[model samples]
Target: MKKLSFSLLAMLGFFAIVFVSCKDDDNGDPAPLTPTIASITPSSGPVGTSVTIAGTNFGDSPSVSFGTTSATVASGSTATSITTTVPAGLSAGDVNVTVTAGGETSAASTFEVTEGTAPDVTTVVDTVVALEDLSSLETAVVAAGLDDDLAGDGPFTIFAPNNEAFDSLIANLDVADLTAVVAALGGANALAGVLQAHVVADSLPADLIAAQDYPTLNAASTITITVEGDNVFANGAQVIGEQIIADNGVIHVIDSVINVEAPAVDPGEPNVVRVVASPDGLGAAETNWTADNTYILDGFIFVNDGQTLNIEAGTIIKGRPGQAARASALIVAAGGTINATGTAADPIIFTGEADDLNGSVPDDANALWGGVIILGNAPTNNNDVGGVKSVEGVPTEEGRGQYGGTDATENSGTFTYVSIRHGGSLIGANNEINGLTLGGVGSGTTINNVEIWSNLDDGIELFGGTVNVSNLVVSYSGDDGIDIDEGYTGNIQKAVVWHTGSTIISTDPRGMELDGGDGPNETAMPFTTPNLANITLFYDDVDGSNLTDAFVMRDNYGGSLYNSIAFNHDAPIDLERLTTLGESSYDRYTAGDIVISGNILFNINGVTDAANFADLFEISNEGDAALETEVETALAAANMVVDPGFGTGATKFTPTADAVTDLDSDDDGTDDELPEGVQNLGYKGAVDPAATEPYFANWTKTWAVISQ
Candidate 1:
């Protein structure tokens, strides 16, 4: 009996050890403790007030709640503290603030909410100083000694750059901090000029800002407001924070600095002077510009009515960098003439002020200032009360800026052997000034041997103009190479567009963009029936992801394309005719109103079958066989497989002898049938390969910026 009792005790001890091991295996790890809230900063004020919560065990991704409302955690959330913003629509009272982290809740802390009042009680300076994000800007204001002016202003619209903006500017300037930034801006006086550029006398909200150009305290500059997508930008600086209202003004937080100074000019440079024109417009005096001096345009210089601004050959005009409202441009108003006739050896040059004339500025640098604007009294589709309409990239309220009248034979001026480079400033949402804007220019004007390079917008844009252009060269344009809109009935001959690609931030890039009219006015009178002949468009080696098209024809456009070559484009043509417009490009083609014949499409890439090129067009099968045969015959006659020796300079468009001789047509190199208004150049492309008078070589070689 004693031995059996000892055995039972041993078995019980073994069972207890087994049970303890099983229990340890079942409970692998210990659970975390609940978080605790210690305190909050300043309690709270009202909605949009930033509050800091101090606590313990608040893991990464904590959820904070103020009473029944949720608080937004801004940044810098740690286990010890969490920054948050007070939610809106909360009543003024003491509320309990609780934090939850790692699925664990914390105790509630008391937070007092204050009354929310209108922002009119505070001044602009006080409002900017109160915000932590604008602390740097506030310091700049004080350093510039303009704090008192902002505080005592009657009404002002202030574009205050945030701390991040100041930091970026400092880094760009290779400076240490805000103090260095103030010192680098040439002390307090220069800083004051920059600060004044951001302040407008009127209280311009987002809506009002998109409509007009507002004058600022800076006499030489103005602030231009633009709305792109869903956000607002002031002089390319995006508005990041919410608009703050004040008693005397409104504060808009920007992500970038506005109105930064340009590169300093050398004092020893001959004939270099900064001329700031008045915003009201230039006088009607007869001004003669000589070739000896360099004219620097500082603002919008509009030659009023009865003015004749004569520019001699070899004259160089430099436009200063400024906002859209104060962009430097030579505008010829109605009844004003700009006789800028330049010879090929000494062409008239219009460029940015940054260009040192020593080839320092690259060809891709664009939008440093505004371009030339010539407004005349020609007929247009969309007319105002007195057959006049406001041109784009100009103030609508300015009556003198209006173009369009009933005179289809109106004369503007002459532009020959001129080169416009690095222009086209953005004026509004998707609205930029083109390199050469011919608005309602009559057929009496003479425009020949023009070269536009590295323009921020379209190279040459015609708005309901009857003018004819010849020997045009456009390269590296930010937008389309050529844009014809409204009821333009012009004729373009011997034009060459090379390196056609979209800008870095562009949405649409095309070789040619044609629009008959705006909106539902598809059948607008005198349709966009421009005659284009001997045009050569060369595409860059751009990726397929870019929005690049050879031709974009929309609305009720009626045009003729003859003796043209479209080489290596993503999309050869895109016909976008809204169903509401009632007429389409296909319909126009069927009616024989639009002509697309005698054109050579070579090495056409992107989503197209090279064998059957007719499939690219949206026309019906009524004349499909005939159109296909014509295209094939043209290709064979032009010897499309031969390489057209394209050089690397302005006079590089000299084709080989075999490329010029037509095999099927006349065999002497001329087309069998030429269009009514087009001239038979005896060549397929813009350059006459027969060694005759070449368009680009004879015109653009002397003064155009081709390679260097």
Candidate 2:
């Protein structure tokens, strides 16, 4: 280095400074660093345990893998660290976890998987939050206000859907994200119902998952599990991977979200955002009323001939309150079909518009809506032109309302697990609609597990036809529990009729108002002969007015009653003798067409003289004292007058073991032969005492306060 002149030296120093500044500025964006893992939190944990990886350079959209299994990278991940959960299907041993980000792979870090008989104490919410695939589900749970419930000590079984499933749902809905999906479904309340359909209120493991229907936490909803070989599907959604067990519950990951038939719609809310009105016409096309919305029956909504009305389970149908022509109802005409089949967990509900379905309804809630009317092509003795008459509640102008034909085995579709509540609106003068009106319904139609509650008129009335019914619960009816007319010839089994014994009811609230036929056709062919068995009729006193009758057989009625019960009624049995008709109900009883035996009548009319079966009717035994003595003799032989030892309140018909044994002893095959459709249960009164779960336990409402 030679010492130069001052000017030259200053220029050289300036060039050196310029070169140094250039080098400093040219250190462009640090060499694209490769992610490196320093340490892993809690060196050991079981599958589904949250493990944090202290690392460097974990860019966006990083993927983590534990050994051969892929781990789910949880939220709150950064360049300096990565949080992940131990994935399922991995062997219990030490494994290496690695992260790949920015097209750069990270070195492996040691992690021990300690799978034990029991997993760590984590709630369902915690487990859902820990898994990345369940991110959408977690958001939904929170939005639906189910997070807290899942976190509580529920021991629930959650069928969780993956992210791809949610994405697919969003794509199918043509929406953007979960929020958009929620909005598309109606609102948070609707979304909640859909989400709740995936949650069961029990800890059901995969091994225990069989092909059956399971009730969900959603009110009036259920998920059907179908086992196809080794794979199990819930509502057509396949259950993937092993079940993740949590402290509070078990989680079975599904490939898709379980599709709810209908999400709950708040029809009672003012200015409801969604209200599906009836179609514009007398004849409705084949349409579906999904559970995802609330339907409004502005007037008599008819499923005309050849049309179909498919109602999904858990659907809420609200009828607009009106009378006469404006009365709202669902009428299934002849040749029309109504597929309203609901499971025990999810019943099709028909109520007024004011009902919120929050159990806020009182026991006396009646006449808030109309009822269901099903008609079919069957024989009738109405004596009208062509033997066809307009269904009582519907207007005669609507030709579709006319029922009855030559076909004796016609079908009107299935109606099961249905509830008709607060119905029976006045359709005409002295003609309020029955909760369930079967007009000439044939034997091919199925009607079972039906509940009629708080009706202004008869709970169920069958006018002609031969449609059999079972597992019926009728409560708080203002009129009769069951009414038969126009030569109805069917069978009714396992029926419970409860009169709240309230004084605010309509006159003549009988347990059974049976008739052979309508008007002058009282002696018509195929008389109203119902083979009824295992029936429990409870009529309570109203303000010390013991006026309710249990059985009022008139108009030459002919039926069979076996293994039945009639309790707390002023008049237990009354047979009318129509002198105009050659054959009366009393005459029919003598001729063996009307059989009433193997029955239990407890505390009849406070055990007064009026309680006597022959005296209650106050009818001439056809000038034959022997005929009256015959009924008394039959009552003394097989009938019982002792207390039935029924469980009080809601389980008023659930008989005790002693009562069951006593009833069974009286059930001799001689005269108590059950019909083809009815079950020949040894013990009687609508309930099998040995059944662990009663038929009326889970589905019925206001059972305890029936007469309050």
- TM-score per candidate, chains pooled: 0.64, 0.59
lDDT per residue as tens, model 2, 230-293: 3344445443333321111112232222333233333465533232234443444778887877
Model 1 agreement with the true structure over 1-708: per-residue lDDT tens digits:
999999999999999999999999888876776999888897768767888888799988899887766778877789898999887644455778999887888888888877532111111211122222235555656644556654433232222222212211222132334445445545544432134323332233323232112222233344555544434455554433232211111122322222332223455667765556764455547888889998888777887778788999999988865444546787888778889999977889898766766654555667666889999998777643444678877767777678888788888889888888878766645667788988888888888889887777788888887888998988777778888887898889988876544342356777888878766456667678888987887776654445366776777777777767776676646555444456755456556766665566655544234455543443222335565455444434433433455555544555553544342344455555555556877666777765544554433422244533
Q: Give the Cα RMSD of candidate 1.
A: 12.1
Model 1: residue 472 alpha-carbon error in angstroms = 0.7
Which sections of candidate 1 miss by over 4 Å? 1-270, 273-275, 279-281, 383-387, 500-504, 542-547, 577-579, 606-652, 657-677, 691-708
- Residue 66 in candidate 2, Cα distance off native in Å: 97
State the number of backbone clashes in model 1: 0
Model 2's TM-score against the true structure: 0.59
lDDT of each: 0.64, 0.68
